[model samples]
Target: MKILNRCTLEFTSIPENVAFARVAVAAFASQLDYTLPELEEIKVAVSEAVGNAIIHGYRNRPDKIVRVNVTIYKEGLEIQVVDSGIGIADIDLAMQPAYSTDPERMGLGFVFMQSFSDRLQVDSSPGKGTTVTMFKQMGLRKARARAN
Candidate 1:
C-alpha cells in the first residue's frame, strides 16, 4: 500500500500539542500495522520532534504552522514534521542529547529520533526552518525488535 497524507496546523505554544502529535502517530501506525513496540517508539520520537518544533523552533509563536507529513510504503513508513519558524543555528549542537537552547529542555529529541527510527534525516537553515524525516520498517523488523 502506497499512501501519503499531510496536515498543517497552527496552535498556541501550549504543551498539549506534544501529546496530540503522538496521538496522530498512533492513528497513523494503526494504518501501517505497526507492532506495539514500534508504536511506542514512534510515539515518543514524534512527540519529541513535534514538541521541539513547537517550543524551541516557534518559541511561542502561535501563528507559526507545523506541518506533519506521513507516507506509507510497502516496506516501511516515513514521517516528516516541518516548521517554518526560527531555525537551529547549529545542527550539531542542537542534536546533542542533554544539550538544549532552553534550560527547561533536556535536548534529547534528535537523540530519540535516531534511537527509534531506522533512519532520521534533519534539514534546517538558520532562518529557513527545520524538517525532520524519520523512517522505520514494519512487520518483521518490528517483531524482531520486540523480541529482543
Candidate 2:
C-alpha cells in the first residue's frame, strides 16, 4: 500500500560507508516484522548494492557520492542505491551470473541481490553511473491487520 515513510541518505564512496549503508537500511527496514533471517538477507542485499556502487562505480574513490533512498510501506520496502561514476557498458552481461569485470573477485553481487530481494532493477548509462533498485515484500498482511 501506502508509503508510511521515506528516507534518503547520501555519503562518500568509501569502504566503511558500505557497512553504514547496510546497517542504516536494515534498521529502517526493521520497522516491519521481518524475521531475523529476512533482515540478514536485506542487509546482505544492501551490502551488495552499496558495495557495487563503491567498488565498481567510484573505484574506491572517496570523492564520489553514493546515494541511498528507502521507502517503507505497509506491504513492503523499496530501496535505491545510486552513484555518479563510470557506468556499466552492458547490463545484460553484467547481470549474468559469475560475470565480472574484475578478475580477482567473484561476480555474485547481482545474484545475491536477486536472490535476496523480491524484485531487483538496474539502470545505468555508459558514463552516468548506475542505480540499483530493490523491493522486498513483508508478507505480513495478517500481522499488519492485527497491528492496525
Candidate 3:
C-alpha cells in the first residue's frame, strides 16, 4: 500500500511507555478518517503489543529498548512493535486464549490485538526477539457503505 505518513518511536522497555506508544500511534492514525471507536481499538491494540514486548519479551527488564513504527497507508494504519529480548518458542501456543507465559497475567493480549485490528501478525525466534504488527483499516469506506 502507498504510505501517506509514518513515524517511529524508540523507548526503554518499561510499563509506562505502553501508554505513550498507544497515544502517540493513535494521534498519528487520527490523520485518517477513523471513527472514535476505531481509534480506541487501535489504542488498545497498541497497548497490548507494547505491553507484551515489555512484560514477556524483556521479562520486565527496564533497560531494553522497544521500538514502535507506525505507518499510515492509503487503505489503513499499520503499527509494528519490536523488542530485542527473549522471544516466543511457540507462537501458536502463546496465542491461545488465556495462555500467558506468566501465570499471574491473563493472556488476552493477542486476542485483543486480533479482535481490534483488521490483521495481526507476530514474528519471533527463540533467542532473537519479537515483532508484533497490527493493521486497522480506515473506516471512511465502511461508514460510507453503511450510510448508503
lDDT of 3: 0.91
Q: Which ten residues in a row have the lowest lDDT in candidate 1?
A: 2-11
Clashes of 2: 0
Estimate, for each residue in 36-143, the C-alpha lDDT of model 3 and write its tens digit: 998999999999999999999999999999999999877788899999899999999999999999999999999999999999999999889999999898667764
List model 1 lDDT by residue over 84-130, tens digit each: 87898888888887999889877788999999999999899888899
Clashes per model (N, Cα, C within 3 A) = 0, 0, 0
lDDT of each: 0.80, 0.91, 0.91
Poorly placed runs, candidate 1 (over 4 Å): 1-13, 141-148
Over the stretch 64-148, how does candidate 2's per-residue lDDT look in tens digits? 9999999998888899999999999999999999998888769999999999999999999989999999999887674477358
Give candidates' CA RMSD values in order: 4.2, 1.5, 2.8
> What pairs collide in candidate 1?
none
Pick by TM-score: 1 or 3, better one: 3
C-alpha TM-score for every candidate: 0.85, 0.94, 0.94
Instruction: Give the higher-lDDT candidate: 1 or 3.
Output: 3
